[model samples]
Target: MLFNKEYYSKAFEYLLESTTYLIIGGILAVVFGLLILEYHTIWSDNWTVLITVIGWIALFKGILLLVFPKSFNRFKYLFKSKGFINFLTVFIILFGCLFIYFGFFSY
Candidate 1:
């Protein structure tokens, strides 16, 4: 494939930013899962299944983010607006928190 410096640069920046959030989310999810496994007496039978699924899905997504580096390049334009970028960041964080919470507490 032909290289476009501009495109690749933008893509790299966005991918880096998004991947950071993804990593943070992954860590949070894992920690929450561990917490549930350690202290919670509820859902002992199925907790393993739910935690395994969530952990696997998050790990898969994190690997995909690192492997497919171009998926987020199109978001470059969206970052131009400060409000939009903040909104997107907050939305992503909220989504991650909710995902972790559900994975831990939903059973």
Candidate 2:
């Protein structure tokens, strides 16, 4: 979806228009984040540390979504920016690769 400009824009716009979707997504993010943290709170190893950080980020993003749904309108411009989308896509791919390496090869 990130690569597809039209679809991405449409989806983002749909999300912006639907406060109920955002609220549900926010709740889910918070629940999943808490679940992750519950088991990996120690952060003893690299994997644990990474998971913990992701959990915290999810929790923070969920809180932001729930508390400031209107504020997200300010970021709509970012979804339209091809450069930002490319950067975000690259970042996601790299992050996924890192997770894969840590999950399968680090040991």
The worst-scoring run of ten residues by lDDT in candidate 2 lies at 39-48
Clashing pairs in 1: none
User: Against the true structure, whose lDDT is highest?
Assistant: 2
Give the best candidate by TM-score: 2
lDDT of each: 0.57, 0.82
What digit string (tens of lDDT, one per residue) describes model 2 on residues 1-107? 55586787767877876889889888998998999888877667546588888899999989988998777778778877777767877898899999898889889
> TM-score for each prediction?
0.33, 0.88
Q: How high a TM-score does candidate 2 get?
A: 0.88
**How much lDDT does candidate 2 score?**
0.82
Error of 1 at 94 (Å): 0.9
Residue-wise C-alpha lDDT for candidate 1, range 1-107, written one tens digit per residue: 02344454455456556757656655665565555545543445543455555555555655555565456556666655555655656777887787787778777
